[model samples]
Target: MKTIQRIKNVILLLAIITLTISCNSDDNGGTIIDPEPTTISKYVVGFQAFPVGQASPAEYILDLPSLESLTTGEISVEGQGIPLRGWRFFHSAGNTVFTAGYSDDDKCIAYQLDENGALTEKANFAFQSTLDNYAALDDDTLLAVELTYGGLSDKRFHFINAKTGLLEKIVEHPIDIDMGSGTVEDPGSIPWVTGMILRDNKLFVSYHKWLADGSYITPDVDRAYVAIFQYPEMELEKIIEDDRTSPIGVNGHSTGIEKTENGDIYSFSTSALSAGFTAASKPSGILRINNGATEFDTNYFFNVEEATNGGKLFWMDYVGNGKAIARIIVDDNIGAWGVFKEQGEFFKLVVIDLINKEIKDVSGIPIHANRYTSPMFVEDGKVYLSARTGPAIGNNGENADLGETHVYIVDTETATATKGAKVLGLALKGVFKISN
Candidate 1:
């Protein structure tokens, strides 16, 4: 049986696949379908596999589509049965792996991997006895922001020595504001640290500034900048402020900030604020700001109206020649395009024309009606999407709960979507390009 992680949250992640193909479709109006090309290269998918109810943690490095075979390793280094909640593969000068997770005890733990891709007991850290948000600054340095409890605030950021597992530098600022009379405090509102990215020698962090009354405040348009710093020293250099859009409020959270080759930065968040509301109550949107600007581009907001809650952009990338293709996984929207309400409730992989800012709807492609899927584009113009054979529910519901998901690869050059492979008990997560 396939091992699955029991995430207490509303949703849990599983697997991802990608292939190579064309960019156009045929007269029949579907992704071009050709035989699974032989030009494919094997990309490694490192995942955490655990059963639904058990705490026995095992790590997996699997070649997707071949569910039967797996290179199994145990995450039993420092502590036995550490629950892996999240994983990210970073860019390195040499080969290195940095993974962060919560322990079975609910404390934060960051683990390192050896050159051979095995989890190492060499570098490890227990984060302040709280659930902390962390990202790799690089191979040697790491950024860790603490999660607050009982309406209390913590540090804004910390720089840790990835090699020595020691705190190098720290940034902590306290904010005091009333939580309106009669409102209780929620510790979950702790500035949920989203993602961290590096450009030039500067570090950019996407974080929500938490408010005192148990709620959070989106950064002011002037303050809605990537919290900037320099490397190694982790000094507060300055903020990459933008003047592109007016001051709009976010729910004070965003996924990882994405950067293009042209040095443009992009970020998305699920918020509950109106464009005209105060900094604490505006709706959520995907915001884009060019480099060095202090304003949120009013034009860059993709409003998921009325729903203050939704899954985040788990992955984003530039596809197509000359950066024409853009794919983003909005785990809450479930692959629907346009300003539709139902679109924001499920997981979705949106294919957008970045230059034109147009996302292709299911009607524009060959996907079944309401058959939501997350897609990844690999080399040679290939796009891959995965869907469960039955209903659109993501959890393990009745009706083929195990191994019902299907993967389809679309060759945009040929404009065809074809069923490429099947996996038992697998749900598609994010995709990474392994080759040029």
Candidate 2:
């Protein structure tokens, strides 16, 4: 019996030793396991930087804690941030941010936050032509369009899965309109797609008739045209025209058309010479299409140029509550082609009440030049956009002193603006909020 008790005591001591080892293994360097890192969400700012001696500008995307925090200091992309292949346009849907290479590279890359709270490339896709226009059909899908210069070839539309960064489908449609008597090299007048939106199972595409000879000559400037198509099916329904205003939208700018919160679609027409129009036959104005309707409302027309006393609408985006934030060129003598060439500061930020057809200038923002600006980021009745204080490009095609570029925060209700973060680059291409 004593021998049996001795054996039992030895077993109990062994069990205690095992328990002590298991509990102190981490301190003793025995296969320690680390906790998983937590992922974070951040706001991203795309900056176009021109190094002092470089011939071309570099594109950089940097993640920030908040846009408002950039108000005091200058933000630069010098040893930090992700550099893109070339100059690109930025758009965000859901948690992913899409960047499309404009000229040299015909690729689109989607970026999202990683576990380290850094912006990382999520997916990459390529296209034959530059994506001129894009719209988010839903949180998961993005619709992009590519149109050739002369509109002689078939226009291609891409439906992409925004979440997966995959091209789901491609729809092609031929240009059936009479493009005048001209060869493929120089079609006298071709349809130039400016903006597109999807609403109520239908898609509306706004365009202008422009010359193909690189003259920026808008041939038919007295009519507003919108092509209506069946959404999801991608079938053409009809092309509606309104003679009340010039062609809807401008080249390289997507603010030519937008949809409001109440389901009403509004089209902006800038028949001003500064807005890539070689001629101004009709005054700049706004046209509307009622909810669930494909045709322009016959009784509704907002003569914006007349209302603002000759202020031409340069760009606009809808804010909620029947209002829109717009950039208006107040100078009547801004020479033709100067706006696109970045000649002077003629753009003034304003808030327009679409319901009352009234305009109020936003205080605190100086007259600025908008050679190339991204779509405004609108959230909770506030709009955020990059407002550069100087010209983006000099007259000699060299990098000019692009004064300070700041993210301007505009209050839709008060019609006031407060300068936000200062960019240490040539310009701030876009600002976005993305998640990992």
Candidate 3:
């Protein structure tokens, strides 16, 4: 009996030891699980603009929610009363948020975003312009445009200082091109209002050459160049032109430019040669201008017929680690998104690889085609494309909701777009930028 009792005690001790070891192993091993991913916030603003003779309206402000807590399928616009319009940021202000808009009458409104995401109205100066697009310089000044009725005569640009509310018209020539010098076949009109960016004290303004039909041709003209000016003095520095062609391999036109964090200007144009306007919906290509030499980077080129061209590259918002978030027209011939085939009817947001210069279709996001304006990055490593959310019209009589704009914050970091929110019509055009 004594021997048996001793044996039982030994067994019990062994069992307890084994159980303790197992518990310890399970606790330590289970706690070594992976951590959740992190992302950066993307700031965005709606380019809300209306045509002339139309009732002017105010743009809305929106706050994009994180991919983790997206329940309502949309982000919230924290500020309800703030209004904005055709505006651009100033890299000199450390990329501070500065914008200008038009109020009823001839006044141009200026605003700055405080650290708290609140817009402080800085200046309200009277501006007379039939067409205008404004770009902020540092935190003090902006450049915009003014044109006569029907935009047939002299169209001028104004340089307005945010501090003193002073407006100065800057037009070296009454018009961008010499109307009488050459027998211009098809003159594409400059966009209603043109914009300018100041870099190294040089202002680069995009010039639009109108076509003969009065309808502004897609951006892809070699004659189209970025006019460089000396700020404050507004002296002509140089007109930077690129090698571009027209839609259907016809006339050339170039439009949008984005300065990368790496100090390179990535210029994009609508091309006639690469993809005919009607087929690809418009001309498309991205030209890299560096060292005073402009070369069309094949990787960034969008050839509509080519499998990679997607459809046509419209706008490039920013350059990421190795790619860019842009709005590109994808052909419905491939049955993408079952979207409409009409030009501008079925636009899709795309993420283009800057290194390889290849574009990947990201049109799976649930939103209207060609609706997103500013595609920005968010804190969660997600791409946020602005969506038009409302029905057709805003009570304001302005072309209110283009397509029920909403925030499609996609996390391609995970190879998926996880966060999205749909706001009503007015909320679609709301102002949205990342905080925290």
Candidate 4:
């Protein structure tokens, strides 16, 4: 009996040890199990969509691999209301994804993807009355510039610490882009900031001396300038100007300046008349701000229009190894606005060798009328082009419903494009990629 009791005690001790070990393994109120690995998303495509004719475009996201249904319009079909507010293609800097709606109830929103590929909304910033153009400063910060029409006193800069949910506002700065000396803006012209680029703690603001009254005018057509300021402190540094280009970029968009692998910052200015009538003397060209330099390099001007023998620069984004994919206005009659209002008949896609100063029109990419094209993305010496085409309209608008868009994967060496997934209903505004 004593031996049996000793055996029973040993068994009880072993049972308790087993229970404690099991409990330790599942300490966080759940069982521990290995999860199947998820594929890291290769690409995230953003679409600007509308349900019907002339509706304000909404935002949509396409998750790769399981792309059975690619359009966000299908979400509306699933009893989900598509709540879109002037949402532009999202901008990604580091780990966060961000987008904004101009003068809307929700001024901005940002999201973060978890390790398992689940996305969570990190912030939704609502403005009182001012609308802003936001640019990503980093994964944890965003810079919002409130334009003048937001009440003149609305010339405020709001910096949001996206990680900490903290915001700081700066209201005063020395801003005078017009021909005048003081902050008093030129008559019939307002300052339209195209975008902001941050470099080594300095902020470069690209802007146009816009012609108001619903018209376009370049007051001084020969030269364009960008305002440099001390970042975080928000003090004026100096205005850098170059006569090689009309404006530092196209109108109201963020593709103006690109930084290459060599850390050289290149700016493209379109000399199109619709972009405010650039001087005939100055061709649409490329200007460089050498690495770490606050001023333009006077000796480095690659005349893009001259390179194409009369083509005007439209849009440009840098690829690796001193090359860029560019859109040039190949014809003069189609003009700038006609690319939007009439049909996209004037633009041509080409490869630019920044080092060699050569421009070659990309072949195998169809040229059809499109109102807008997606902001191109570069990866591994290739560019992603998204352009939507529709039926041509006559002197009177007719048969306009024949619209379609596709994503093209291009090989820079061959200058040929192969089409990928077709998107329905909306145009692809931008493509943001995620690596596994």
> Where is model 4 poorest over a 10-residue stretch in terms of lDDT?
72-81
TM-scores, all models, native as reference: 0.54, 0.86, 0.60, 0.78
Q: Lowest lDDT 10-mer window, candidate 3? A: 246-255
Q: Write the per-residue lDDT of candidate 4 for residues 1-436, one digit (tens) a residue.
A: 9999999999999999998888878758646778887756645555655445554556665444433233222312123313346645455655555565655444566655556776556666765544345566777676766555311231467677756434556455535533333333634455656667788888888776654433455566677778888977778888888876676766535667777776678888877764445344577888888889988988898987666533777777777778788777656564445555323445667888887888887876666443444446666666776666554445444544565666666777876777666765445666666533
Off by over 4 Å in 3: 1-58, 61-105, 112-120, 147-155, 162-175, 181-195, 211-224, 230-232, 247-255, 271-283, 291-309, 331-345, 370-381, 389-404, 412-415, 426-436
> How high a TM-score does candidate 3 get?
0.60
Model 3, span 157-250: residue lDDT tens:
6666655555645664433443432345533344332345556666666655544344444333443356766766766666655445322111
lDDT score for residue 435 of model 1: 17
lDDT of each: 0.40, 0.79, 0.46, 0.63
Question: Which numbered prediction scores highest in lDDT against the true structure?
Answer: 2
Pick by TM-score: which candidate is best? Answer: 2
Model 2 Cα displacement at 377 (Å)? 1.4
Q: After aligning candidate 2 to the native by TM-score, how far in Å is the CA of 342 from where it should be?
A: 5.1
Clashes of 2: 1
For model 1, the stretches where C-alpha displacement exceeds 4 angstroms are: 1-43, 48-94, 103-122, 129-142, 156-190, 209-226, 229-254, 271-285, 292-345, 362-389, 392-403, 406-421, 426-436
Q: Kindly report which residue pairs in candidate 2 clash with one another.
A: 70-421
lDDT of 1: 0.40
- The alpha-carbon lDDT assigned to residue 39 of candidate 3 equals 34
lDDT of 2 by residue, 334-370 (tens): 6776576432577888898988899999999998866
